[model samples]
Target: MADETPPVDEMLYEQLAQDALRGVIRSALERAALPAGIPGAHHFYVTFKTRAPGVSVPPDIMAKYPDEMTVVLQHQYWDLTVEATRFSVMLKFGGMPKVLSMPYTAVTRFYDPSVQFLLQFEAPATIEEIAVEIAAMPPAEVEPLGGDDAPKVVSLDQFRKK
Candidate 1:
């Protein structure tokens, strides 16, 4: 008897999985945008790349966290809006309110500490994107790191059953 397994298509499954995971963030934000707000004790810690394209934050905030920043979606936030590609919300810092707008692709981490659920993502910038960002930055801020010393994205695949 001949084996009858179908071959996998050439689709990028990793990208597909990433998109689905990001949809979870979008869905959560959509829920939070409603009048009921965030539902029960559920809250989120959303971390994103400060320098990623389409991310908009106050100048002081960009200066302070040039690499990445995490914002908590809890009692103090307001004006939360979630769109297909991006989301924005007003959050207070140092007694002043600032609005942060960012594309979902910029997000690298999403955590719900109340449930201890966490999702981490790889830096979404491509080589060309990274180059463009580095070139746009001031000379003083661009520093090189050895490959081995660079940060890594931890994958859950290793823990999954084959």
Candidate 2:
């Protein structure tokens, strides 16, 4: 009777999109968890706000990356534990291992050099709000491809109502 998909609020939708984007990271890490290590030519360049919430880094890392920092996840990284809410990893800045706890919301950008796909999220309203949102907001929905409607390919139903 009515086409009632509400108009997208770009801002809110962006948040949702970003949340979904992090799901990709989550899934990748989850898969890694299966084998108990990084797998299958997959690596990440994760850039996050050092000052973001739930983020813990050594003093030296903070001093070097006062604002934002990008860490590589290839050939070098340890204790790469990823959970539903947040992922923790041990990385070295100057041959010294440092632990970092980062919420997905704190992640401003994620790049996988293996596949060459990247996702970038807009800055949260305030640097102060990042940690809160990352800890609070549930993971956003993953949108299906082909948009709202399927492509023009006319095909028989695979299920055919069984």
**Local distance difference test values of all predictions, in order:** 0.85, 0.74
After TM-score superposition, what is the CA distance of residue 35 in candidate 2 from its true location, in Å? 3.2
TM-score of each: 0.74, 0.66
Candidate 2 per-residue lDDT, tens place, 99-155, comes to 988888778888988989898876433345544545675564545676785544423
Sequence-dependent TM-score of model 1 = 0.74
Q: What's the CA error at residue 52 for candidate 2, in Å?
A: 1.3
RMSD of each: 11.6, 15.3
Best by TM-score: 1
Q: Cα RMSD for candidate 2?
A: 15.3
Question: What's the distance in Å from true for residue 117, model 2?
Answer: 0.9
Q: How far out, in Å, is residue 86 in model 1?
A: 0.7
Model 1 lDDT-worst window of ten:
153-162
